[model samples]
Target: MFWEALGSAVLGLALAWAAVRRLPHRLPARAMVLPTGAAGALFGAFLTHSALGSAGLPVILVGALAVSAASLSLLLRPAEGLRRRSATA
Candidate 1:
């Protein structure tokens, strides 16, 4: 379980970093993104594992990654709106 969580965190961080790099405009700082991604992935993995009762590791990991990405995107989305509003102001 520890290794699973760590793996999920690392994967999440990498995915988050890639996403941050792909953004057309700057959003949040790396410090914020990293923790958020890690936590999101960890929580996602835990949730999937618990909910499924006895799922495979691969399934849990994939679910973790997907949820992590979705959560990060959702978290960062508000910043985009704020940026747009500021620019228009």
Candidate 2:
């Protein structure tokens, strides 16, 4: 369980770091992104573990990655001029 948690955290942080590096303009500040990723992964691990009951390490990691990516994706900023204008306006 300990190793699973540690691995999940590391994977999440790495995912966040890669996203920041790849899309610095799209993501919010590191302060918010880093924690979101970690928390998301941790929550994902717990959730998966509860649902699947230690199915396997790879499966748990996959679940963690999926949730972490989703959480980070929420922090992404939309491109300029991409907002849909009100049709009635």
How much lDDT does each candidate structure score? 0.79, 0.90
TM-score of each: 0.77, 0.91
lDDT by residue (tens digit), candidate 1, 39-59:
889888998889885587787
Residue 76 shift from truth in candidate 1, angstroms:
3.0
In candidate 1, what residue range of length 10 has the lowest lDDT sum? Answer: 76-85
The residue pairs in collision within model 2 are: none
Top candidate, metric lDDT: 2
Show the lowest summed lDDT stretch of 10 residues, model 2: 78-87
How many residue pairs clash in all the candidates, one count each?
Answer: 0, 0
